[model samples]
Target chain A: MKFFSLLFFIIGIQFASMAQTPESPAIVFGPVFGDSKLQELTYYKINDIDSVQFTALKFYISGVELIHQYKTVWKEANSYHLVDAFQEQSLSLPLNVPTKLKYDRIKFNIGIDSTTSVSGAMGGDLDPTKGMYWAWQSGYINFKVEGKSNLCKTRNTEFQYHLGGYRFPYNNLQSIFMDMPASQLHVVLDLKKLITEMPLTQKHHIMSPGNEAMLMMERVINCLSIKK
Target chain B: MKYRIIIVILVCILLSAFHMATEQLFVAPENWPETTYDFSKNPLTLQKVELGRKLFYDPILSKNNSISCASCHSQYSAFTHVDHDLSHGIEDRIGTRNSPTLMNLAWHKSFMWDGAINHLDVQALGPISHPDEMGEKIENVVLKLQQSKKYPALFYKAFKDSLITGEHLLKSISQFMLTLVCSNTKYDSVMRKQTQFTTQERNGYMLFQKNCGSCHTEPLFTNLEFENNGLAVDPTLNDSGRMKVTGNKKDSLKFKVPTLRNIEFSYPYMHDGRFKRLSDVLKHYTSSVLQSPTLSAHLQTPVVLSSNEKVDLTAFLLTLSDKSFLFNPKYSFSK
Candidate 1:
């Protein structure tokens, strides 16, 4: 009877542990215009006349963390995700967090950090082959948004903003903190809000890292919000 | 007990394999400063260094595969293009500045005439992406290397992964460059009391210490600081050097101080290669130093060298050349 009870207890403990440990929680990014989901290279109606089409929309999301009651409960190891609007897979970021973990907020940086920027070439999403690193100088392009608009005066009516800088007096890295309600972890990046805030025609191209990049980077993070 | 014995033997085998993989490939010359490169991140190995050497000579890094790093930086000329005032690149394109000599680069804090590149690993990106130079993107280069028959195997042998990454590629190049130590010069011999300098050479050394030692410091032969050496600005090129990088007027006309080692073969000199001969460089220091607000503090007090003193200085400068370094078979192209 004692041996049988012990076996039953062990099996019960295994089942209990299995119940406690569920699947890994995931974070999904939803890039949308005013009312609809964003489609790459497709013209979106902004107003009565001007329509903008995004050829490329990409940004780096790094230093991911899960916060509970204002304390960090869990953090991703070497977390760096290059979120691309063109790629379907890149939007759904997989977090290696236990489903049992509790968190009220999700915190992350919108760009590459200063330390990683100076630390030579890296592989995976941080690789120079990803077309995100500057060739003439040493630094990563934190956020790249290239598109054409009928409103612009330049050739091809194109506007390109490649925002990144890790150095002082011009660091473009921005931190974001969003509340996680009901464990959904879905973040919405509204492109309409970003475009509406800035004067597109005048501030069309911002290629290098500077004060302009800092301003554009602010606009980038300002467009992100929790999809509750 | 048998299982335990087998485990012990397996552990021994594993330990030996690890030791062989990380065996020291670079030994720093005694008493030199600690290298700036973080070798822990990319440890040196025999396979990686050999792979880097092959890559250094290969023209596959260029756009049309017509130009290689060796085209502009020949080993015989101490790894710099000789007689070319400006760097000649692919399609006979002329670069804005002179191609700096490559020697004892392990000590360099930054690359390029203007100190634009912050680290050595990212230095190749400048030339590779420059329209006049290689005119190739790093993405295309990685793709080409992956598709190549020999590179994938070579990369696997070096990094233990057949998949070629930019990190592995750059780290391997750094391993080869770290081995280009030039400490076998005549001046080095004299310093070690292996030989004595001629009386004229000794006098020239004293003059050098007084006049030029501050900017071009000892041992490494460069302080590794950017300074405006007072070269008259070329009206046509109108290059502002370090100022363009920092966007500060205080840094205007400041260029990285070139190492005096291997100066005999590595010329024409200066950022623009304006001075063809060592004598012309000396003349510029003595009489032709263009005075500007950003001129190096050391050159503020004018250098006055007599004609005979110039000859002694030239003789002393030649002693800085290391035949062993210039002709090292290890640095040569291999199949």
Candidate 2:
């Protein structure tokens, strides 16, 4: 009888511990071309004129923060996520905030910061093996979008943009903020907006971070929005 | 019971011996600025430094397995390419800029001629992936290291894991490079008040202070800032130096100010290795400074050095050479 009672007590403690831990809310990001969901190799019209198709698209989102009112209530430490359009699981980020806490806004950086760029090699999303690192220049490519477009006059009608620069005068890292509700949050990236804004004829191929890269990076910021 | 206790003590001793053999502490020179390298990320270890030395001397980093880092950065020449104006790498492919000497890197905020590399740990990627240099992808290098009979075991000992990662590869190389500290020159001895310079050398030291002290600084012998030294752009290379990285017109032709330490063996000088001798370098400073929009303000005023003063300055520059650093067997190949 005594042994059975002891076993019951231990099991009760385990159940109580399990009940105390809460499930984290999921923050999902959906990529789309205006109203339509994005698919690889799908033809899309930009400004209803230029026919464009994307083969690859990958970018980094870092320094996620939860803002209540005007002040920052919570900020994720060492927050870096690589979002690949083809990878379904990469787009969603599960945050571990308390269920009772309320947040009015979400903030994040569109690219890796200067500290991580110079912090040598890293693993996970910041790993050099992720095809995001520029082996020739010793910096990570913040955003990479590769595809073919009829509007692009280059060979094979391809357009590639590998954007990265941590130094001053051409630093391409951008910050974003959006209003949030007390429920599951969804962030959307509209490809049509980016494609329409970019002047494909005058300049299309942007591999290095410069003034052109900064301009394109600005368009990337404008394309992101909170979806209801 | 007594035997078991004895065995346990013996095991403890063995474990401590192994720990001592593997771990090492990085000690900075007294009165020097704190190292820019964040040691918390990649801690120093004797085993990792040894592994880095082996990798530095190995040609497996190159695509063809023909050229090693030692090919360009030989110890005798103060870890710089000696004769070639520009660095020669795999297949005798000529590079655009001269290979700079590698020493006192822990204090450096950036690397390369144009400061393209922001960290010493990531600097190896530049040469390894350059078309005219090693021309090997980092992934392939890791794969090769994983397959190598000797490297896997070495990596296991250093990193406590058999798997070779790009992070470990870079951090290990950084550990070896960090050990390269050249502070025991004759000038250092004078600064410490252990020795006195000869009359000629002393005179040269005065002249150096009056003319070049602002840029060259002291101890490390570099201000660690980029400057436009007024060298005419090479027609073939057309290198814009720091301007290429920043895309700012103000940064045009502004190459990093190199350390004067070991400058004797580190010639030919300049970004493109345009000056072959110390005399040529002095001549450019005194007589051949080309006026440009981006030229350093320090060089705007003419450096009028008499022939005798030039000789004195040269003698003082020679005092900066640390023979101990050049011939230190610790930095040489393990075998």
Candidate 1: where is the Cα deviation over 4 Å?
A1-24, A98-100, B1-24
How high is the lDDT of residue B152 in model 1?
99
Query: Candidate 2 at A173: error in angstroms?
Result: 2.3
TM-score of every model versus the real structure: 0.90, 0.88
Q: List lDDT for all candidates, in order.
A: 0.87, 0.87
Off by over 4 Å in 2: A1-24, A34-36, A41-50, A136-138, A181-183, B1-26
Predicted candidate 2 versus true structure: per-residue lDDT over A128-226, tens digit per residue = 767888876767888889888999999989889999888777788998888866655788888888888878777778878788888899888888878
Candidate 2, residue A123: the lDDT equals 74
**lDDT by residue (tens digit), candidate 1, B221-261:** 89999999989999989999988777679999999999999
lDDT of 1 by residue, A1-228 (tens): 999999999999989867763534567889898888999888988899988889898889999999999999998998999999889999988787775678888888888999898887788999888889988878889999989898888899999989988877788888888886533578888999888876797989987778888988888888887776
Write model 2 residue lDDT over B182-263, tens digit each, in one string: 8888998998899999999999999999999888878678888889998888999999999888778999999999999998
Error of 2 at A205 (Å): 2.1
